[model samples]
Target: MLFIKRFLDQVDEKPHLSAVADQLREITYEQLCSRARRAARVIAKISSEVMIGVAVNKSADYVVSVLAVHLLGRTVVPLDSHCPISRLKQMITSVDLSLCLVSRCQEDKLTDMLQASIRLIYIEDAIGEEDANDNAESTRSVEEEAPAYVVFTSGTTGKPKPVLMPYRALNTLIDGMAKATEPRGTTLLYASQGFDVSFQEIYATLCYGDRLLIVTDAQKKDLYALTEQLSKERVTRLFLPTSMLIPFVTFSLYEGVTLFDLSEVIVAGEQLKVTPIVRRWFKSHSRCRLINHYGPSETHVVMTCQLDNEPDDWPDLPPIGQLIAGSDAWLLDERLQPVATGCSGQLYISGRSLALGYYGMPELTSKSFITHPLTQERMYNTGDICVLNERAQYEYKGRHDRQYKVRGYRVELREVEVAVLASGLVDDCLVVASQLGLTTSLILYFTAPERGQDFSLSLHSHLAATLPEYMLPSFYRGIADIPLNQNGKIDTAKLPQVGGVRPRLSSNYVEPQGQLETLVCELAAECFGLDRIGANDNFMEAGANSFTLISMLAELRHVLGHSFRQTDLFEFPTPRLLCGNVQRSKEAPESKNSIASDTKRKLRSAAIHNTHGRMRGRHA
Candidate 1:
């Protein structure tokens, strides 16, 4: 509430300042506050101090709706407009949400999908229907102890538990960010609406009285679109998932640009690793300033490790450096006793940045959230394995639990294992997890009665229904038996590695012949961090998302000299199919050339110019 009050103060003082802008339009602080006031009139009619779902995408409407909820002293539950209908229904049911601010375009879908009892207020129409002068403010005081927001997890562990983040904690994060970065110019609101990072984006920008550039849903993952928007918006502050930072920078470099000339790139949402390429890139681009962070959703950010100064002596995974001010952390062993410096132990964070525990999970909360021995401040066991080096800097080891991050989403190995077992296909399964460079992947190793290409295909199809793409295993390998040590426990060391299986993605095997075909195969292997991937392997089946494709496409453009659209990969995922398409696309113009070479070259130049013009127009 304090943060909202501060943001509102900015809205009142700097009425003409740029508040938020998207592809279609921009809004001043006055317009944004006015719209939020109008929205508050409608929202207050529902119920005060109740949870309200804002089922919208990355837009000004979402910003307005969240503010409206805060203005009414209600909690905002962000339901991504593009989320699966099943996930949406589950969240709505779990939270007992009866009212949702739905975009006009998404009304029919919500009406059809949701129960008749639940009401969907069309935010687009509601924004303008009520007068800004209406006195519909709730009587809730700013001193009220209520949650600011509840961000839902990816449900990879089991079900998505809502992480209750209080207003004071939220306020503290933004206040800290303002001091940490002294943010100026526009900040990009680029993450998913439901993500906790988006919380940082919205509040950090507005609370600090800075501008926010909202990227459209379509432009979110498309590197070409994002780069253009970044350059056009002149974004000076940006935060990206570790998964996306490298690839985006790679794409920007290929286009002869850094992500931004004067931007502070804070890479979080997952473990930040400094590869040789990332190290070299940061050093070469002197203007690039980066703040690498590591923490769980429960703890917003525990440390700020400077990434721009990645020394040649940097390890594969650098230490998640010094703690944030006012944060007291402990490296504890299993007994919760302090471990010696330079010894690996689970990290327990006691700080203002800790969340107010998981919503509706008191037992679980009591277990993880404990009182500090030295300081009685409520502390959270991060379940993250870390170590305090002799230099007094904390370094990340890995997660103590089986949990891992997939594209910035928290995923538990047990969750995937449970889903795999529920299929009634495999009795015993061991998910072999690995990370290559910055990409994290899983390989399902199971013991089946009969093993062949059909086994993997069936399991893949079964998983597609229950698990999200990021949670699915990239490779399916059948083992003769579950490896066990003398203690009768599964020995990961004894299990067969992925490449040794000598299995094709599908029954139909197609070997690479040409240079382009071979290049596609290599890209697939590298992108997915696979030791062996056939030309017939589907990228999606191999856990390759758009982020992977962005990096892959950048390389292809450099090597093949053919600029291809991102959509081309979805249809032709296999290397054979993609290679064919690229070849045909390349030869199409030359094969059917009715115009001269000079005219074609001129047309190409004009086309590029027009594209840039359109990109500029979008941000206008």
Candidate 2:
């Protein structure tokens, strides 16, 4: 059955049930259907294009606009509101989008960013109560094989490639999820709008007659806020990126709070590690199960491992588990021949869950989606290296590109990361290879429970006991947290520069000399959750990012009664430098340099406010 048909049936069954909600408002199934119908009529009058862009923020309106596009049998190209104008333009141009749906609040900003050739339709206007009874269903029949939506890749290698998903593929995902997870009261919509996971969060919940709770940016950034919201809302189902699982579970365990109402916690987008803290969390909240789902954007979700057993019995590194319904996977060697049982090989997936291929890039699509040698069937070449264990479950060894040669020794980055995590000293760790002039250096970036604690020596000793000498990281850096991009995956680009002079750890802490310097140190310490911040400590090296910098700037402005530009933090990264600048600024408040600094500060504030507005519209 068509997903749209199923959704409509759900609406008929539960007309007054809450379908989707954000922090500000809630909409019932009946109201959602009405809004979609209204928006569809407006879109039909605007254009006959098959592909429509939905650029609205994550809210009930965003959900309405997407449904309206589906109602008209048009493929949706979900655009991130926070993306740079250049990147958004690339996505729009790549999809050949002629019309985009924008929210009233963001219409002006989008108008300025988007080309004049691309028409912008206000979602508020489109869903207005005019012509309430107009026919919204498309006159043209939408075939099951026709494209349903387009989601772009992360573009780590090059330009982001648009993966076209057809209706049949979406159906496969919905059906598979229904079988894997039991129906619950509510599912948190934690993913960003453009992410493929958002589709699963939005559609899967609505199809199951469950309320979809959209998380706000503020809640998502703060662990306490997120957990409180989850408990208050009685959120039964939750999905998190694998990188976030450890920190989230650790925080929850530290608080000694168990969300007894939560039924399932699904994690994906990276390898799953069932650390001691994670096991304890699940054991305490016995009602909640941890499910590790594995799939690339090319195939929505193909395999899943559910830790239904006792937490103590779970493996440290859980397997990706068995294939989902209607999905088929094969482990093939370099020559495309099937690998022997228990041997590692590249994973290949073939089934209805496969996407239609990259939009407007036939060569790339042909390269990634190839024909199986023995079966002569179309299959996606998943670059993941995996091995079948004794239980017939697939264990994720590592990614094909993540394997590196260090000092003439083969090393899997994941293997090293597992070793660090097993030490139990750090909450999370990322192992990366840094290329120097003539030698490659292994750098380990980690986040520990106590940000002020220096555990480098202990971590090194722990890894040395298990891993070979070559696998050990040459340098260890403790960060405030593992940086995750908007999509909730580890943002490797945001990791600190490896070759630079390392910052002095807490052990070599230096005291502040003056009142101004002391104030700066206190603020830095509070922001980073460190007990003490040295006057000469580097900001970026201490795990300061754009968000943390903005926070510190706000606090500084409050206390100093003077505005400071973000660039000031970049220029004078240390507490000592910042205090010196503050003293100078106070002495010459009206100087020419001060005037110029004021102007730059205003511009920075405006830019930050704009970003904050977009964030407010998204999940917490």
Candidate 3:
């Protein structure tokens, strides 16, 4: 609330400009301030306690509607455009929403749903309805302990649990994030709107007089054009999931031809396992900076870790890293005892970044956020397992609630399962960390198309690039189909168990030849913990990436007595293509100069032309 008046006061100075539908639409500072105030005035006339859903994509109207609700002193729930109508209906009913701010594009799709119980209005209409006299004259004391936004998470109870985040908590997060990333006039891309991180992006950009680029739901799914826009827009900041980052790297946008002059790139949502080639490509592009960010939604946006080292130098699985500016963390044992450095335990996060609690679910909130028995400070039990390293940084081990011990090592079934999914071997996969009595074992369940090629061999090949030997699954099982729970999560309990035998594919493609291929194959076999390697295997679809590929390249280069950059492998991912590229690079040149001779020739040509033009002008 402290930011409200200040944010409005500065609105006329710093406006938000967006490029949409191939046209540059500028939202001036004064316009935004005026719109928010107007929208707020309109909303204030409505019921204050009633929940409202703002269903709009990346637009000025969406921003204004959000601010309007804030001004009206009401909680605004963000519902993404991508969510299904059924889900939206359920959310509306559950939250007891009295009104919905529907975007113009969404008007046709959702017009029928508007009824007597819930009023619906287009964002543009609401903005237009604001009176000229309406201003921030009616200032009130800010609510110190009230919910600002309620972000929902997928729940096992077949419904989403809305996590209520208060203004004070968000202010704490904003302060911490601001201290860590001092973006002065920076432009940050808003990737996830429904997610709490969107708020961070919004506040961060507005607070620092920076620009917030809202990527349309369409643009996010379109990688090729998105890359083009990123370069053209001169966008400097970006934060998204690892899944999204992989394509950005694999496509080689970092090499050149991007719209934006990206200075900082932060990836989160899931674990970051960037390939060596990706890292090397980023390093070469001196203008762009890459960071691995780790956090949970419950902590506002981020609580810990800003990965600042080489992805390869990091652990087999990189450490998640240290606590953030206004947050603290600890690894605790089963009995709530603090674990020593390098010892794994459940992760607990504390400090001002904590949220208010789950909306209308006080018991569940109490269970997760509890008093630190000794310090008596409120701490959030993250339900994640981690280890505090010697550097006092945290290494993500697994989920405490989801994983269990198997032969002394705590096995994260989902980690293995995600690796499997990333391998592109199976359509749906789930690794259950269950036991048959005292003996512990993992059951890998997957489903693929009946006619589609088997991925077992490819899975082994891809896992070699990222996972360690000990973390490998004890058994592989193929189900006719993977059962999905009502909440859309994989139903591991329903997976039928099978014998401990690797399924064989019917493929008959011959393996590629040459010593480099042989060496690559050998390294793949070792990294994957596989007995054999095949030629027809794809690098990424099989889950191989810049990180693991780098490891393979490191070993291969050492044996070959020459260094190969990460770009070479990514350009030529498979053994056959990789060997060809490697051979070509080796035969072409070993020069490590920053600029090529041809580039110098072009620069000299331009300089001579400029000199001649200047001389001609003086004579005239």
Candidate 4:
């Protein structure tokens, strides 16, 4: 059955059941249906476009907008409101969007950023209209091959590519997920609307008569608040990116918070590592199970590994497990021939779970999606290297392009990351190869329990014991947190640059001399949770990222009664240099107007700081 019909059946069966909710409000099944119908009527009257864009924040209105588009048999093109205006504009043009639905809070801003030719409809206005008789049943017979939505990739290589998913593909995913696990009772919708995973979170829950809990932007950033909501709302099923699961579990365990209602925890979007903390978390919460899911945006979710065994028996690196129903997997060599059973090869996928090709880019689509030589089936090149184990399960080797050569030796970045994680010296780590003019340098970026603690010497000894010289990283940088993009995967672009003078790991601490230097050092120490910060220590080397630096600057502005821009950090990274600049600024004369202007600037800076805090809550 179509997901829309299934949802309508659910509404008819349980009219008063809680359907969807956010921080502000909660709505029942009947109310959600009514709102979707009203919004659909408004769209029918104003626009005839088939592709409608949803550019609202994470709220009940956002869900309503998506359902409204589906009611009219139109394709949804989700646009992230937090993305830059230029990027949004480019996406709008790329999909040839003529109409977009937005919330009243963002209408003015989007109107200015979007093209004048595009029509914007306010969701509040639609929902506020007089209650009308439902008339969308006729449109419920949407063709299975019709486009359901268009989701864009992160575009690490070049411009973001749009992948068009059909209704058949979505239905297959919903069925597979239902069979994988019986979803029930208040599942959290944590993924961004633009990401394909959001579809599973939204449709899979609603179609199964489960309540959907929408997380607010503020709650997402505050771990304490997020855990409180999870326990208070009795969320039964939760999905988190692999990068966030460790920290979330560790924090809850340390805080003595009990999520008695949570029964299942699903993680995806990266490799899953079974660290000691994870094993301990499962040991404590015996009722809750950990499910590791693996798939790309093109195929919503095709494989899963459910860890229900004893915590002590789990492997450090779990296999991605077998393919779900409605999907077929093929391990092929570079020449497109089937490889040996145990040998590693590029993974190819075909069957009902496959998406319709990339929208309007036939050349790129042909390059990625091709026909099998023997079976003559249309398959998508997953670009992931995999090997079949003795248990008939596929183990993920790194990506095809993730392998790089240094000093005439090939190195798999994932292997180095595994070694770093196994050392247990750091909480999280990411290893990447950096290219400079003609030399390629291996850099390791990591986060630890003590952000300011230097682990260079210990890590060097650990890697030297297990890995070869070429595989060892030349530079190591500690950060407050590993940066994650909107989709919850590691954001390599946000990693701090390693171009400046490398600080000696074993250097003697230099004490602050004057009051200005002392004040700077004290604030730095407090921000990073350290005993004291040396005047000559580099902020970046001392575990400072762009987000933390902005916050530190805002606090400094409030205390010193002087304004400092983010660029100033690049110019004077050390506390001694920063104090020197502050001393010079104090010596200059100030007028009454200048003081008033400074006060206004401080207020503005405070607002920006709050915004940054919200942005920091997003998982990479």
Q: Which candidate number maximizes lDDT?
A: 2
User: All candidates' lDDT scores?
Assistant: 0.73, 0.76, 0.60, 0.75
Instruction: List, residue by residue over 395-493, the lDDT tens digit for candidate 4.
Output: 888778765544323355777787788899999988887642112457898899887788986887787665544456766888888898999988889
Best by TM-score: 1
Q: Model 1 TM-score?
A: 0.88
lDDT of 2 by residue, 204-259 (tens): 88877889998876577566678888999999999886656765775576455679
Q: Give the clashing pairs for model 2.
A: 215-619, 215-620, 216-619, 216-620, 217-620, 220-620
Which pairs in model 4 have colliding backbones?
484-620, 485-620, 488-620, 489-620
- Please, what is the TM-score per model? 0.88, 0.71, 0.66, 0.70
2 versus 3: better lDDT goes to: 2
* Model 2 CA deviation exceeding 4 Å by range: 115-117, 130-140, 155-157, 179-184, 402-535, 541-620
lDDT of 1 by residue, 275-388 (tens): 656666666666767677767788777787775344465666766878876577898878777887678998899877778887777887898899866667688988888888
Error of 4 at 3 (Å): 1.2
Worst 10 residues of 4 by lDDT: 611-620
The reply for model 3, stretches above 4 Å from the true place, is 12-24, 114-117, 129-131, 138-140, 179-186, 253-260, 302-304, 307-317, 403-620
Using lDDT as the yardstick, the better of models 1 and 2 is: 2
Candidate 1 clashing pairs? Answer: none
